[model samples]
Target: MRELVFALEYEPGCNRVADALADHPDARVRSLSLHATAEQLWRVDHATGTPDALDAIEDAFLTSDYYADCLATEDCGATQTTRVLDRTDDTLVLYSDWERTPSCASVPHIARDHLGESVLFETRHEGRHYTWRLIHSGEGDVAAFFDALEVAVGDCARMEMLRTADTTASVGGSDETQSGLSPEQEAALRAAVEHGYYESPREVDVGELAEHLDVPRSTLTYRLRRAEEHLAKQHVADERLPEDPSATR
Candidate 1:
């Protein structure tokens, strides 16, 4: 099984929810899972900053042409999902299943549809784009997948591939290569590594790193995630590249 993790950026012009998220700098959507069939169940996590931002999101979602249920929420935000349905402002009747309706063409929905039988993992929205991580049968059909996505977005947005890799085995016999990091990400990840943070939950967490660095916890979290992502991408790319024939020189 070949697994690929790619980041898909959605601009405001693409979809309503994406636009709402862009308006709120701190707001983000983390895709938990998507079960597609007669009726699609989209499980997602949402985070917002101010009351106005929250209100905007609610307006876009609750009034949407589907059944939505709020499962949980806290200071950070909430997690929820919408049952798949296709409705418009002009239509007052509601359909219980997607067969009777047009269907909502979301990024997650489109990507999952394109992949067909492949398994899709958790999808995350950092700030600008929604990151989708999935595993496929290694058919190598990335170009075709993006073509479908572009059509879904309707020329409103385009996707940028941040990272992709095959997870069947270690490409270079190691998880990561000798790559450098940005100043901020380096500091945060370095501190975690110093304490064996990745070693079976042995040493420390982000909070400890924050305390040690005298920086805010959120700041540290952002830096560490980005840094780790960079290292991981490098690892995948390096493993896929052909070996150097003149290394002895």
Candidate 2:
């Protein structure tokens, strides 16, 4: 199988949902499940943020012009609905079913059209960026699909190709273990690495990195320390275990 990861950033005034996400940098949305067909698309999303942010997101989602456009009769024929499956002070579980039409040129539909119905999708939304990960059997017409996606977004959004590679190769070696790190820890570690916090000269300090991530310096430091300790333990464990038991004397 192959994995394709990409991101989209819609211009302001182009998509209400995107606008709400952009407005709340501290908020995050993740797709728990997604299934799309020619007739409709079903998605369940988990959102986390301040209560005010969650409220704004819910409001924007319920009355989004993007969803409205998909349900427009001029575009296609189908029923459209959304429900709040669950909610908390700072979290929300949302379910949406959108009827598809020719005018509905969403990523899922475009992917299904090009990569077939067997593809798996995962998505994350943060700040102004919406990222998508697609896993599919064999190498499908990825270039064509990207082209169609660009056309679909037209002048509204910018598309970025993040990664495209064989799933097995991308998973590192066969003995690679999962990093037992929380999402925040992983984010902190990633930002640190990307910003050269570990360079010889230390291109960025903890305070600067924390500021860049919009997080408290102490919080970022704690997360990075925890992540580093976890990874160090994993490395030691791997070193102690021989790939072949018989090879150990």
Candidate 3:
């Protein structure tokens, strides 16, 4: 699953920040890693959530009136909101050329130190996008936050203009391509594999498999529907059926 953990540089003692986000109908903040001057919030969301969630959150931090007014607008260049072109959390420590600046310089190092484990997501400025890493205290699905950032940044005036002007470039397809299958669907596919249900005359019992998994049979059926959709759309070959059964039957 796609995930992110960004350290939003916010004012000290601003409870409203988290509150404002968690209260959003489309987005919710799962947890927050806070300190005196800044707080790093972790969020996760289902792949089915709206397209604008992550952009919104990014806008709040990048275009914050407090920070923008302090820095030279010229250095700001063009702000862009790149969607989740790709995301990964592996054993490797990925670095980026967007080094720390006077305003955001300490952020990367501090975030790395505070949250040892991190995952980076590709972001776009106008349409010119780059990669940014998010550090986390521990492993948590922070896809929710990234989705929010996408929504925030998409609406951001400065960032929107940057993207429109071709200042940002993305690497891959949109989130729809990135989303493979839901967790429930995956479980069903696994059950189908283990139970050997798709075989010949000696077919496995769906109810028995559902019982083994401790899920309702109907739930399993629903999962199978999703699995079939993914498999059919992706043109994944069904492994259990070795031959065209209708030809023989």
Candidate 4:
């Protein structure tokens, strides 16, 4: 079984959160957890129910054909829960005590209907095209699972996989083969330099960089620091490599 961590973007104006975040580009959603059912738990930065901020979100819920329920606020740390109705054979029935009674609105139900019930949704991006970390147990037909996902996302939703990797504890891949750092670490440095984030005046701040990179500020900062440290050490090593006695006449 393999775990696929990827990014995807959906058609805007199709969902409450997607529309809300689209209207407010500066604000974004991160740290998402999608359950076995359609219920999803996610945190949106700075979308604390202000009229202009959540206008799209409220409008979507009100007009959606599917029955929907929302709980949002600063006290809630800017979180939202979406449940959509399903009347097909894929309808989900929750057996876990930790889960809410089976609801029609859960997105995971799409996967559950066709991909078996062991799928996991770890992280997500809430922009025009939503990004997510979807983990499947590999117990079902992989091809069918994705096909079902596309249907659930709707024809208007645009989705794609950003990257794929097998499950293991450490981060080892092509990046480590060519360089000592992981791919994410290298990306962090690139993002920092590309946006002039390292300039004296700093055109972009760490928070903005984090939002753009779809990672937490601390995560972004750590990767950059680690990448820089790897580079610095490599520089010192490269300079000293030729000083050995083997290089002397």
Candidate 5:
């Protein structure tokens, strides 16, 4: 199997959902499930953020056009419907189903055209960036897909190919594990460690670190806290003892 990881950076006003996320940098949306066909697309997404951010996201998804690739300027004869399956103080589970028209440009349709129907997709959205991971049985027409995607996006967004490798070769082991940190979280943690922010004599404060990273202090703090939380949980899991001690034997 082969894996392709890519990301799209949307320009302002390109996509309403993306713009909403950009407005609330602390909010993140992850695909819990997604399935697409030539005629329709169905997806379930999990979002986490403050109540206001979640509200904005839910509103955006419901009120805006639901083109998976981006926003559609002209009516493509498509229709979208959304539902809030669950909600909490800081999380939301959303479900959406959209009917597609031939004129509609979406990642699933493009992938089906080039990558075949055997491909699996996973996606995450944060700020103005949408990242995708695809796994397919064969190599597929990657170049053609990229070209087609670029044309579809027009001048609204930039597409980047992050990685492409054989799944078997990349799956197994790594010398340094991140304990499930997202790219943003990893960056925050790395910067903090390098700047001696964790040292007893604290070389830099949170505000200073945020300035160095060129991000808002609140955003930096959120990333750091999330990263630390993941690391702590991972450490506890690793050190956990089996309920039945004889299992070690």
Candidate 6:
């Protein structure tokens, strides 16, 4: 589930639309509506959980000038699948209903008007099921504004996911190198192993070995990790690498 802000062009006291809908038998508590702006309508729901008939409801609102344009079709009604169906002239619908199944827990929130004008919103991603309204004081296409907003929200989500993955890999040895080190680093690693630098006598602390090799401690650790990874890989490739193939010969 995600939260979304809606920027509408309604008159004062028009915020009751959501409350009225809430009284309906079909409305879900998770589907909340609030006024973020006097002219706007804010709504929230599970993007992936909504019914397929939402587009029809949206079309209903759009054709009716945001519900402020007065009801035309006698069949203008709502179902559990239709959370909002407006018929007012000043009432515009701004919604966030994009959903993905087999999806991550995150939802994208958006707030824009019919002319695509932007309204105030919190961070790049929608945290949870939320609905709020914003008054679009500017002149812009609501659809275009929302399109851009969606793109921005999506980009932010991607960046956050990538960053989280990178951090996790760094902390958990996720990016084990094939060679376990660059050529130079591997040379140092071989030297450390042969010199018994990593053995139990405490003959060489990491810092000491790093200094002896004229390399930084950080560099030594990195090389060691690489070396370990490489050796492990080689052990898998040639099982004899661990017991000294030269000794057997």
Which residue pairs clash within candidate 4?
A: 9-129, 10-129, 38-106, 38-107, 83-105, 84-104, 84-105
The per-candidate count of clashes, in order, stands at 0, 0, 37, 7, 0, 24
lDDT of 1 at 96: 23
Candidate 4 vs candidate 6: the lDDT winner is 4
Off by over 4 Å in 6: 1-181, 239-249
lDDT of 2 at 152: 78
Lowest-scoring 10 consecutive residues by lDDT in candidate 6?
Answer: 156-165
TM-score for each model:
0.51, 0.69, 0.26, 0.47, 0.72, 0.25
lDDT for each residue of candidate 4 in 1-249, tens digit (9 for 90 to 100) = 456544445444455666665666544434323454444433222223334545554445445433222211112222334433222232211111122233332345565666567777655434454545556665766567667666555554655543444566344433253465667776888899999998999999999999998976645655676578778988887788657676685
- lDDT winner, 4 or 5: 5
Candidate 6 lDDT, tens digit per residue, 1-249? 112233221222222232223223132223333223323234443211124233433443334322321111232332112334432332323443322222111122233323333344332111111222233444545456555544433422111110101222332222223443345555677778777787888677788888888866645654575458657776677765477678989
Q: Is candidate 1 or candidate 2 better by TM-score?
A: 2
lDDT of each: 0.53, 0.76, 0.36, 0.52, 0.80, 0.37
Name the lDDT of candidate 4.
Answer: 0.52
Top-lDDT candidate index: 5
Task: Give per-model CA RMSD.
Answer: 13.4, 7.2, 17.2, 12.4, 4.9, 21.4
**Model 6 lDDT, residue 78, Cα:** 21
lDDT of 3 by residue, 1-249 (tens): 223312232222222223234334344322112221232222221111133544444344444433311222234332322233222231111111122234331322333433343433332111111113332433443344444344333332111110111113232112212335544556677778878877775367789878988866645654575468667865654555478879889
lDDT of 4 at 179: 62
- How far in Å is the alpha carbon of 229 misplaced in model 6? 0.7
Error of 6 at 246 (Å): 22
